[model samples]
Target: MKVFLWNETGKEKEIMLEDDQITVPADKGKYIYEVLAEWKNGEISYTFVAEVQ
Candidate 1:
């Protein structure tokens, strides 16, 4: 599984992780995050919005 994030005014950035958790440094704005899950069956994508301060 991989997570990607970006603000409404910029391109998406990939979030790297050493474990199940990862940290993202965001500026004050609205951001949208997407999770890409790769499985044996197929690939799945999930999206969510975040407000950063």
Candidate 2:
């Protein structure tokens, strides 16, 4: 269940990561593309990609 804190507000501390996904409090389906695009860097970062809904 690896997950990342996909917070739209850009607040890293507001994350609740797990496995394979992120713990976003809001409906991801509404902001998936935006978040992924804003955070995607293809580096060793723990947070790379994430689902919306």
Q: For this target, which candidate reaches the highest TM-score against the unseen true structure?
A: 1
Q: In candidate 2, how many Å is residue 21 off? A: 8.7
Model 1 segments more than 4 A misplaced: 7-11
Clashing pairs in 1: none
Write one digit per residue (lDDT tens) for candidate 2, span 1-53.
Answer: 22234346663443444563455445555323122223355533344554456
Backbone clash pairs in model 1 (N, Cα, C under 3 Å; residues 3+ apart or in different chains), count: 0
**Per-residue alpha-carbon lDDT of model 1 for 1-53, expressed as tens digits?**
98887666654688887678866556677668888899898999888877778
lDDT of 2: 0.41
Output the TM-score of candidate 2.
0.23
Quote model 1's TM-score.
0.67
User: How close is every model to the real structure, measured as TM-score?
Assistant: 0.67, 0.23
